[model samples]
Target: MTADDFRLILFTLGVSAAAIVLSLPFGLALGWLLARKQWPGKAFVETLVMLPLVVPPVVTGLVLLKLFGKKGPFGALLERSGIEIIFTWKAVVLALAIMAFPLLLRCIRTAFEEVPRHLEEAASTLGKTPWQVFSRVSVPLARRGIAAGLVLGFARALGEFGATMMVAGLIPGVTETIPLAIYRSFHAGDDDRVWMLAGVSAVIAFIALWIAGRLTKGRHPF
Candidate 1:
């Protein structure tokens, strides 16, 4: 309703979108590899991928902070390059993307697993290269699940709070997202603003889930 509220909504949307875009390619590649390939340390790799899901959000944020803080290795490298990540919107994107990754990877992996191998083999016999078969056949067959994963990732990113707060620090009109705004409004005793932001968050989450459900309908049991 207010300019600040509008800004918060926009920031949340931007961060969520950035998170999805950042994670999708990696999720798809890793999911496909996990689904279709067998290799050493596969279980270890999977457990590592799912670590963020099991760890406390604050812990995840702290790890990120230590890795990207000014004195840390990556942070120092970036600083030397004149790139700052700490306490920025980029940090918000990183936090959300990390938190949303496991969900997206799991969904996409399941979708890839559900694609019949025989279809790929048939395409291969018809002179289709592996890449061609995957692009034309496997991907299309698994599109519903991929779309669902994308929607779920976006919803998760939109609602992310703990890690984002730890990294971005709730700077209004800079890195403040919907959840951060709600926290600020509630703490500031702005009950009307809190309720408004909460309602908007809930509505956005509901719409995302509904779209995911529709996209995955009759496609996979997941």
Candidate 2:
């Protein structure tokens, strides 16, 4: 592989990792709350979380662009701190996080909901703090599920393209990721490059799925 190809692969990996790291905690927290608590406007929150799954990726990207572009509220605030997300690797992370968060949340919420409430009550009776029970009992029991969610999120991030391209653009060596690289090569008629990158992505995605399955012990039922 050429240096460009290697660099592109590395960029994809880095962005996917960043996306997973950013999305995991938020997804888990939201999912746990949704599972454990009853609150007003819960439906609205759930719909928002699931938006990426249902909305066209291009639309999602466009929304992100508007919200994060220069002169946009959040973008302007971030710009004051010398941080720019639009058309940057950070944009890729944002797109991937948005796209993958729902999947992670679903997995985590399911895991959390499946926990036995009696165990929590028993822990409370034994004088364990709420945070202690959550940290020790609930989390440990759900560790495998959370790991599976992470792997799935990573894989989803790896394959993300539409939203990423719209927000991050295909700036080679700067924000170019594997899927974006494949799209560029294909559109440029560089069939060899396209095939090579596509193969790499497929392999990586397969490996991610394999790891996720092993972590979940095939509990996802395909």
Candidate 3:
């Protein structure tokens, strides 16, 4: 691999990791809420959460662009604060996180739901507070699922392309990730480089799935 290829690989890995880290807390909270709570508009909220999964990547990217572009409300506010997101690595991270969020949440919510309710009730009866029960009993039981969700999220982030391209603009050594670099190489007729990058992506994805499988082994009922 060339120096540029190495750089792109690192950038992609960094962005994917950042996206997962940033989304982790929010995914956990939403997953738990969806698993355990019943409320008005719950279905509506779920549909909204799952929207990105179904939407075209370009469409998602466009929406993000409108919301985070320089003239957009959020973008303007951030600009006033001296933080720019559009056409930057931050945009790439945001795009990946948004795209991967629903998958992560679904896995985590399923995990939470699979936890035995009686265990939580038993803990409650034993004078354990809700928070204590959740922290000690529920989370531990669902940890495997959470790990699966995280791996899935990371893999999704690593492969992100359309939305990231729209927001981050494929800036070399800045926002160019493995997928983007591969796309550039293919279009530029760099067939060898394209194959190499594709191979790298495949290997990374396989490693992530292998780790996830190990984490979830014997835990899932299936």
Write out the backbone clash pairs for model 2: none
Clashing pairs in 1: none
Task: Assess candidate 1 and give its lDDT.
Answer: 0.91
Per-residue lDDT of model 1, residues 181-203, tens digit only: 88888999999999999999999
Please identify model 1 stretches exceeding 4 Å from their true place: 220-222
Report the lDDT tens digits of candidate 3 across residue range 196-217.
9999999999999999888777
Model 2, runs deviating above 4 Å: 218-222
| Candidate 2 local lDDT, 1-222, one digit each (tens) | 899889889888988989989987787778888988999999999999899998999999999999999978889999999999999889999999999998899888888887788888899899999889888887777778888898998899899989998999999889888988887888999999999888898899999999988887744332
Best by lDDT: 3
TM-score of every candidate relative to the true structure: 0.95, 0.95, 0.95
The segments of candidate 3 whose C-alpha lies over 4 angstroms from its true place after superposition are 220-222
lDDT agreement with native, every candidate: 0.91, 0.88, 0.92
Reference-based lDDT, residue 179, model 2: 86
- Superposed by TM-score, candidate 2 places the C-alpha of residue 44 at a distance from the truth, in angstroms, of 1.1
